[model samples]
Target chain A: MNFALTSFRKDLSRWRQDLMQTAIWFAIPLTVGGLITMLMSGDGAQPHGVLLIADQDESFLSVLIAGAYSAGDIGELISVEKTTVEEGTERVNAGEASGLLIIPAGFGDAFLDAEPVTLTLKTNPAQTILPGIITDVTEIVLDAGFYAHQLFGEEINTIQSLVDESNDAAVAAIAVAIQNKIEVVAPQLFPPVINVEIVGPPATDVQVSLALLYLPGIIMMAVMFSSNGLASDFWVERDHGTLRRLVYSPGQLGSFVIGKALAAAVVIAIIGGLTLVLGFLYHGVSWAKFPSSLVWVALSGVALFSWFAALQMLFSNQNTASVISSMLLFPLLMAGGSFFPLAVLPGWIAAIGRLSPNGFVVDKLTSEITEVGAWIIDVNSWLIVAAAAASGLSICAWRLRSGFAQA
Target chain B: MLKVDELTKNYGDLVAVDQISFEAGKGTVFGLLGPNGAGKSTAINCISGLLRPTSGHASVAGHDVVSDGKAARQNLGVVPQELALYEDLPAIENLRYWGKAYGLRGAELDSRVSEVLDTIGLVDRAKDLPKEFSGGMKRRLNFGCGIVHKPPVILLDEPTVGVDPQSRARLFDMVEAARDAGACVLYTTHYMEEAERLCDSLAIIDNGKLIAKGTVNELRAKLSARDVLQLNGTFPLDETRQAVDTLIERDDLDLEVITQEEECVTLTLSRASQHLPDIFAVISNAGGVVTETILRSPNLETLFLLLTGKELRE
Candidate 1:
């Protein structure tokens, strides 16, 4: 018992001091990475807005126009306010209002005589939704104004003139008449809204495809990139003759190698899990089912650590490890859905994703949150990953014990 | 007992150590004397279990270097020609580490370390980094590190190289104390005078061969020359030198002039105790004035020159 403890303590102290720099090396990058992810999570801003308008035409037709435009909840998004035409155009241009309408003098006389009249309407061209909305509301308001004129017969113009001496009843009537004409030509532009309902219980709220599709590839890439420290540590120890000393220590060669692999596993698990938590906290990923999600992630970390150890040992130098890790990393990233949506990726890439460990882990986690995938969690694939890990450990052990450590 | 039996080592076609052997008993100082590349270092390396021999065997305190490497290593302490102290570490820390390597622990290791530091005359500077030390201090620390574990046999490989005369003298004293502590010491050096002054018995190896091995007097007796001869001088006479050289060079005398310096000349006559009358006859006939005459014994330098036919330093 004393012998084992002494040996373990010696190894722990040496390994800790030797790899202190490497830990800081990895931790700084991971922390900065989490910060950057937190800072850049969503699109620029929310897309909803409001438009306010004012109308001063006080005729009964004008009142009818206001009632028509404010006829439904649609106007809740477009409010009317009292103001002059110039003020209204400035407001519309400044984005405070959507549009402005002005009625000429003698508009009541023209409407009573059944004469033509011109109504000036100013539209804001910069707003894609507001201009169209303003046009639609104007047509509705004018159509109602014309209907009110017809219902009042001769008294419509007289009542409008009494309410506002300069009210443009003819312009309002003509605007509604034009909308009525366009109703024959462009009825679909203002089609009635349809209410939607489902026949059964509703499905989940968040789309599984959105998060699961990219996360697997991201995780895999992260695993490969973050495991650089392990490989770097191997090269560092070899250069420093620390590995030689450890190998010469009695009964420690095997355990030392195992300890290296375990250390890599712990580091990868920590950084990978941190990435997941940051994803949840900042990206708003529903990690309510975090327990099982964390399990697959931990397994992914083990598999990655194993692969990295074997591959690093196989590599002759740091440049070789970096190039190989990245080559395998980015391809898995592209396939497993990190950079772009999986739906847009080529079929072959998605097929490759089917074999990717990251894809498997992410798909497993995503399945608990939303049900949009057909990905199967095959036990055989996991077995294959485990077998790969075993083979890697064996190769690393052999190389470390014999090839480089023959002395 | 430390025995090197007919040990041979080769680096490719070059024979670093030819078949050679020697033995050192406990508490004895066995000096390995040689010129540069005369295989002194190679033989010591084999004895210390650092280099394996191509043939023959070496043992430390009866433990075979090859078959019982750990035990053999445990029995021997080696101070290599190059200082092996870690430069960044303090002297005591270096001593402690080596002590641990030798399986010493706790208060035992601490006491041994302190004792070694005191013996090496570095007790005051034990806490200082070796790199900050003078060449002499570093060499002392190197010696301390090697002997801190108290192995049964200690190998000193050119321990005084690049050291000041004062430090070298102090180090020699320390080595003598090591011998007094009951450890067999195998000392190797090119400085013939050092070996002559300190070695209990000496081995003079040349060209990978042991040319001579014995006490200084015994080895000096191998040449056909008396150990020492008297010289009488008067006013630095050339005739006196010529007369002595002539007598010593004659086949019947078998005597040789060893030194002629500053109004006097010294000679080692072959069978001088028997041929003293003949030497006086020549000195008297040369009209040389005899001021003084005295006889003294020969030392290892004369013996080394006789055996190797070259100066030890050369």
Candidate 2:
């Protein structure tokens, strides 16, 4: 039993016995990732509500107004149901429907005859978004009808007077007249006389699900969590007096630390593997790159753990070590894209994240182990992970031997 | 098997272990007896190569603790004051881990672990985690973990601090067994009975300094086989001291005042039981009323109290 191997087995057994803590370490970030995923998955998150139409007029124009609610994108949000005025009022009063639009009798005739026609829209005060949507859509439909009458009032009036189903000549003439009128307004609507530029965050044409957007960051979050936990075990050994016992042993403390870290690497790698598998199943992480991703995550985790272990060793108090490491943990998580992906972060923050250790892993994991459709292979990622792990563990090993156990 | 020569450890201005020197041969228990914070652990740590002595040197089986730390530690096993057994690790796993840490392996490690478990009387509960064990059981497992590899020198640092009576007896047996196996045991404790029972030699320490060192009988002989006489009654503190002083001066008595208080007076004198009438008369003549009295034979604790002018319990 070499000291390192012995420590590896001991730590692995300790972790097995502390299954609840291990699960908590794995579950916290999974829960966080799940929550963020839910938020992102519900991206349009539109409120659903029915819009009741009491079309007492029953005219073609009145029918057209009611049809607007059930057409296209608006139709997905607000369902349109035809009903009597009394029924519409009852539904709106009960808050079952978002709003009621009442088209009074002769309203269509009043509009065509150039007389004032009032359209009443009553909305449920209980809901905000659905009621607001219904009100906005009703106003747009009314405005469009008003404008059409103003622009082609003569043509519409003449067509109404010609009421003969066999009158193809009149129908053709009215259609031609309406076409000419639309052409007159075509320049204003097509290009818009005044150009309004709407600037926004650069759009990614790729329809990245929220889970995919956050998986890399969340994976790093899990690694950080695992690292912090593993780092604290150094204190556990110290507090339990095993460290002092080790000081009396022939085995080198450095080898012991490395062995324990190797065990932590296995635990973290399992976490990474399970999360990566999750990505493959639902978040579109490329299954082909899973093996390499697992290795990279393990390396990144040990590297981070080594640093935390070193930092924890510097402090005289275990609570101080825990508090300081935790303080450092959250910032790293935030800047490294654990809270949000670098692709979605602000330019400056994302820049910092891209240069950060976790951020580097997240970014590299994304570019190299993307969805099957956008996957690319870069072999050099292993070097970065390995180099970081080597440097960090080297520092940790030196720190442990220098005075930690002896102290 | 274990030797410490003028080993001193300093925490900046504080001398934690000040020039403490002692040696324990194979098959013998060398006790470091001191109350809490008396540098017992520090001296053991220095010898065990756990702490670097600021001055002087110590060796385990001829290996210098500082220069040949690994070799020195290779011959050492430490049972710290706190239960060092991992709470999550089962008793057997704890034994095997420490056994392996001492460089034991394969069949040797397994055989030794079982032997140590049997010696500690925990073989039946080998797979049980220490956290689930009774206080005594955990203490036994703690001891088991230390001697699993059977190092030549064993350092037990107050292993019986919080142990129950049953566990204390079990631990005594284990220490004796290790000593009988020809290992030099460095046992540090504050309990006088344990020192008298287990240690072949004792080093009485106080405030990081070795006040006295010798075999238990030799140290007690230093007390002149005196009996400590304690009288419980109303006695003027100054008069009581003066009376004892006058009596010692007049009779040329082998008596020394250990303590003098208003309600009690304590003196260590030769044949205190025989001199009880004289002592009572002296106290009465000094305006003191003796209501009750106690006589204790000379022991290591009496010697410690006499040498340090401070109670061993302190």
Candidate 3:
């Protein structure tokens, strides 16, 4: 009767009675959250492309033009196999490609006579944002090609006329003539160009990274705050006169405090872990990095549990607990970067983040996943977590001891 | 045994419990009878160690209430007038919670909870919530919660105050059972009848002090020299009653009298009913004839009025 062990046991029993409800509370949120994230992340189904091309004449120039955009980001720009209008419709209907392009036989003759020309492009409506980007790039690339042909065609005509008349250009004269022709003929527009070179594998694998880091870390913090509310089982005891009896019994106050904290930690870890794991499942996030992620998740949970004990003791009742919890939770969640990425916050806000266990845990998760190339294996993050854990435990212990003494 | 010796409490500008003292022996029920604001609850709180006395001391089974509170409390059970129970929890759950708080666990705790539930005759409604219980049922659970640990010293503060007649009787039975189980019971109530029916010994408190303390009969004996005489008859409506009053006005006799519509007269005489024959003879000679005359024995209520100059209920 005197031991807090009784309190812990009772808490466990009550939780067991409501185990199904607890699991549901956890499952519903995680499932909904994961689905929301997926839907919001946009349809990741597959990449579909429409290729458009305008070749003005059936000559070597058209062949060379057809050869230029033959691979990768360039090849995907043109639907070369679907030349006719009917073939284009079939290919698009089959979902094999987005659209097709065609050039008239007289296209090169009109361009040689300096006649105006334009090209057409078709796009897929179902694919929302990316199609526009592909269209704009195709227009600029084609225009540059047209101007280059016009400049080179003039230079070739001038050289043929000079050779038939037997004119001496000199080794120096020939060089001067060719240099004048090249200066007038190269493409005029610099195009404000953006050349993206893929130096290594693109980091499109960010989904799992963000999920592995964020899901566990945030869920851990939330569960810790919640458990503090639940762990104040003493409120129930006081009403029952069980507390009075214990205060008179031979139980150690310290042991009771320890038992309460330990039980809370265990409960939070289990609940938080289950939510995160199931959330990952719903999000279809791979767990190849589970081993590393689990370590940080557990640390975060224990740290949160420690802090919660201190907060919970500051309250005399459930209403007070709720008020204090919000007071702490909002600020902690904000500073800890649970709502937004830390880098986006102002300096002052980031400085506040330095004081939050959430911030420390988030930073640890980020480092493990993103590999921001820390000089150490995240020494600063680990130190912050350790400090937070220590402070929380000490405060909890001090408060509980004083509470007993005063009682 | 529970002993409170010279218990005193002060609340800055007022004295709540002013040097009151009493003892409760094994298998005995001691009542602290007083009107509201008479320091009954303050004294009970001090005895239960819920409040610290300004001076003096209270103990349970040789353990100091303050210094050895845990041990003292181990033997103590308190049933407050307010139903201090969790409404959200079922009756059995509430009982189990209190049982655990008393350090009962696992199978042992379960059995004790069942036993206490049965003691209050609430075994059938054990799984129901206190909120759903009748006023009487809730009162029983309140009692059960306190006695679940089977402490040797039980403090019940007006336990039957708001209960129905049935629950009230059950509560009294439970109190008697606790005493029979060797609990030293300190029962407080403002209802004189409750105290009379349940307490082995009683103390009357007025304005934070013990005005009287003894067994009901012993306290009643304090009024042994006085008698309450009731006379009913057709009086001579006028001069005959005046003559009787004039005859009874002598300083040698101590008497107090009041009349009801002149049809019945009650006389308080500082003598036994043995003198009733002479009293009735005087009335008959005055033509204020008595159809019926009765002299009743003094009781605790008379003793209370004699000592405090006010009724216990008042």
Q: Highest DockQ, which number?
A: 2
Scoring the B chain of model 3 against the true B chain gives a TM-score of 0.81
Local distance difference test values of all predictions, in order: 0.67, 0.85, 0.68
lDDT per residue for candidate 2 within B154-205, as digits (tens), equals 9999989889999999999999999999999999999999999999998999
Assess the local accuracy of residue A88 in candidate 1 as a C-alpha lDDT between 0 and 100: 73
Best by TM-score: 2
Model 1: per-residue Cα lDDT over A251-323, one tens digit each: 2445556666566665566656766675555445565545445555556666666666667667777678767
| RMSD in Å for all candidates | 10.9, 4.5, 8.3
Runs with alpha carbons beyond 4 Å of true place in candidate 3? A19-32, A39-71, A74-106, A113-135, A146-208, A231-245, A248-252, A279-320, A341-351, A365-407, B84-118, B122-138, B222-314
Candidate 1 residue runs with Cα over 4 Å from true position: A1-407, B86-90, B122-131, B164-167, B222-249, B252-306, B309-314
Q: Kindly list the per-residue Cα lDDT of model 2 for residues A274-347, writing each as its tens digit.
A: 77787667665546677777777888898888888888889989999999999999998999999889999999
How high is each candidate's TM-score?
A: 0.53, 0.84, 0.71
Provide chain B's TM-score, model 1.
Answer: 0.80
The CAPRI class of candidate 2 is medium
When 1 and 2 are scored with TM-score, the better candidate is 2
| Native contacts kept (model 2) | 0.91
Clashing pairs in 1: A53-A81, A54-A81, A142-A176
Clashing pairs in 2: none
TM-score, predicted candidate 1 vs. hidden true structure: 0.53
